[model samples]
Target: MLDVEVSSLGPGVIERALGCLRNGHHAETDVPYATLSSLLERAVEAQASDVHLVPGYPATFRIHGELAPVDGEALAPGDVRRMVEAILPERVRGRLETERNFDCSVAVSSGGQSHRFRANVYLAQGNWCACLRHVPTEIPTLEWLGFPDALAARLASHSNGLVIVTGVTGSGKTSTLAALVSLLRRDASLRILTIEEPIEYLHPVQGGSMVTQREVGRDVDSFADGLKYGLRQDPDVILVGEIRDRETAQMALSAAETGHLILTTLHTRDAKGALTRLVDLFPQDQQDDVRSQLALSLRSIVCQHLLPSAQPGQRRALALEVLHNNLAVQVAIRTGKIETIESAIQTGKREGMFLLDEDLQRLVSAGQVTLETARRYASDPAAIKATKPAW
Candidate 1:
């Protein structure tokens, strides 16, 4: 014999009661308006780069290259999903549901002060997960980002050819790129167009450059689309947010070949890796064509990383591979002698070019960062001791 539970409610009553329970009792079932506002406020207060809402965990904010959980109750999966849905537009929600992910910019305001957040909401572990990156109201210059004067000057003076900034994720690529764009913005005569998946830094027209930001999924469907349209826009400079695929890579190369100064980022560990990554993006049959175009249009590659400084703050450093497309380097690229390119970078220190290990050694010598940390993140730890300068 089994005991049966009885409900003293009708069909409609039961349905309403269940809905109320789902809304009010489940921790992850919905995100309340008050909670969402508070989270955004906390993010701003802490100067966080990103705010993450995850199920079964407290809200977390990434500040100064570290993720710390906000002092609050853990969120329920359903609650986070509902909260995320409330902030999104109906069309965005519809698209997200249909496509399983969505990307867009969301502006939140309190007391007349507005901050823009680049939001990416996606399905994860059968629940909605959202990450919001804060975008500063004003663009930062190279000085503000702590770039050396020599490097800043070189970036501003480049007339044509490609400039690649390579780094791992959360390594300050966007900030560095923003600084470069800000420098160019001071020039009122140059027309600059940027294609980003979600525009992080907003640059205003100033001096000689007229700045235009096109966001993927908002202004255009893809990077390739934006790149294709950018060619006919009478632009003197182009910034591709990231070269993730061959189409955008080829488009960037084409843009550089046509006398447009192109700036882009790649997720590579070091300068040599940046070159290898670009070449490997193409099919074998197209390797020769890619090598030819790259050798001709290549200008410089700045591979950088952000490490926790010894002074209780984070610092950005560079492991640059500055290829001026000289005969030897061009021959190396064309003839598949990429290993020699590493040697060139090692010996090209006089030309403002240095390898990752060299930069790490400088940082360690300056007491900016520890040798252990540098070695942990370095592309080749063995190269560190070999490249260290004599005290």
Candidate 2:
């Protein structure tokens, strides 16, 4: 049953390694390094979200938010290095040598379908360790990612404004952003320019819209520089991968103000935090001015979290909070009254605004997730009670 067909590696090697899954065969320490590719192929077949390769440990996969070790011998330091070299791109080799940390993507095609993985290889305890996250080749729709269709379309229908997607690491931010890009592609005349650290989902020309993508280290020097030159390329919409620094944030706002739709992501826990984090990146003296720019150019904020699901066949459920820029929200941002933003979201439900805690409660009430699961991740635990829930 373990003789899985794979196109990315030699048939003999694939069959041998996969057969080990059932036969309990362990890799020899001195053998040629053919198991790495086979391991990746198997990881994909299993639908694992991530693969971990570390020295002195067996290969591991993260499935359904849990880590499980593969049935193989522990990898030596030398084995880990060989595995890294097998998939590491030639262009990033120099950067890895100098900085000892880098981000890249690798593609493994099987049966005419391409599967991409976002990889980060870095030095830990004087040895190289790597984490590879699987990225699906075809972009999923917004609804499939667990966004309300009406709300998702409203966020995408805007021709010119800033839309921010905030979430913690491994919370599906990149996939959600890519889904938004796919929605905008329905218009043939719009030109989309995406600057990603390592391009994840490849976008081909669709619906007549021109899609141009650039990688940070490979295609462009940095996100800021990409935005600087991308504006000159006559793009109607720009996707800045993540606003990591002040320059990128400032440039994104400027692009939004100047009649271009700017889409980006922030590492924040909630919608209100997204605004505060962006303003905090600027100097104290200039924060007020940045706040003014943000208030004017902001369109909406969508924050999300993935919690373990109670339903069978569904590994995780998406808990989302959304804030659409209205007069009250704009005033709050302008005056730096960050505390009032939450209240605004509570009252703006008719306008598609919802708080994270409320959504968590909804998920619990509907039995998509358990009460304990919702309580564990709720921003305001007290708001998530057992008596009744809010939609």
Candidate 3:
């Protein structure tokens, strides 16, 4: 029932696919690449964040962070494998076979607009499966996204030092950084260089700033290599996709010390967690040096986490904990008082540092988020309840 011919597949195919899954029968041949492409088209049309392909299941899309089945038939393991192969270029197929997993970016066109996707192709239960995150075609400015304006201006005003926008996966860290870069382009006249793996949001160099984007494994070998050579590229601002390893972190600090503003991301829970993760990346013997270097060269760390907004349409809003490296903050870092960092942030609001709970409370009070949702994600729900958002 799920084996409807690609040419003949049409209305009501989703029901057919679900029935096929119940009966445990699927066409074992290669589904047309256009089949998956059509699913992607539908996903983008629906503003889905990700598309997932798994064996013995229908294609699914992550709409507003929730998974929903795409309008299609259930795919057999072989069918999924073929779908993966169909999307991947032949040159990368060998790497997939040898490595069992690969990361790549692809561009899909639908409705006369091009949408980008970062693809993760991996083996699941010995069957090829893939997860694709839909990257927006246009790079958004902070103002356009309605991110905190003061914070965006502060991040863009930095001429030197390292600024990190940190969060867990699907937390919109990349989009945040991209917006910062766009703001910098509008507010300052500087050359901005970015190094990303397979470059996600293609920012067209515009306004007063010049943007030169390099792709890891394509334009350069790795983040370290691009960052090291970026120092000599006469750039005033550098954006490294993520501080993924010790080597990349070292180079990022080096660039920051050498008078280049380094913007990057780290997969951490909050600003304090980011500092701990950065220092812990180095060996114990080198941690003190890292902390010292970080104390001076760290400009700001904005930790972002998303929560379900009040919009019944499954939308999400950002809650941020912003940390600026002022003198008091620097002293805390230099003294290795990671425990006291949170306290410093609580009192440093005039300098643009605040806790996540503060932002969450603000959202709730503004009617952008519900009180229950805020409590679920807030750092101090009791405190928020006692004293309402002052914003």
Top candidate on lDDT is: 2
TM-score preference between candidates 1 and 2, better one:
2
Q: What is the C-alpha lDDT of each candidate?
A: 0.75, 0.83, 0.80
- RMSD in angstroms between candidate 3 and the native structure over all alpha carbons: 4.4
Regions of model 2 farther than 4 Å from truth: 1-33, 387-391
lDDT (Cα) of model 1? 0.75
Worst 10 residues of 2 by lDDT: 24-33
Q: Highest TM-score: which candidate?
A: 2
Estimated TM-score for each candidate:
0.87, 0.91, 0.90
Which clashing pairs does model 2 show? none
Q: Tens-digit lDDT track for model 2 on 272-313?
A: 999999999999999999999999999999999988888744
Task: Write candidate 1's Cα lDDT for 1-391 as tens digits.
Answer: 0111222222333223234444575422332433565577668878888999888887899876778897756666676666666566555667756776777776666555667788888888888888989888787777776666877887778878888988887777888888887787675478899999777777864576688999887788899999999999999899999998999999899889989999999998777788899999999999999999999888878777777766654534443334445676788888878889878876666666666676777787777777776787776776566345763
Using lDDT as the measure, what is the rank order of every candidate, best first? 2, 3, 1
- Report the error of model 1 at residue 147, Å: 2.0
Runs in model 1 lying further than 4 Å from the true structure: 1-31, 313-324, 382-388
Per-candidate RMSD vs. true structure? 8.7, 4.6, 4.4
Order of the predicted models by TM-score, top scorer first: 2, 3, 1
Clashing pairs in 3: none
Q: Whose lDDT is higher: candidate 1's or candidate 2's?
A: 2
- Candidate 1 lDDT at 192 equals 90
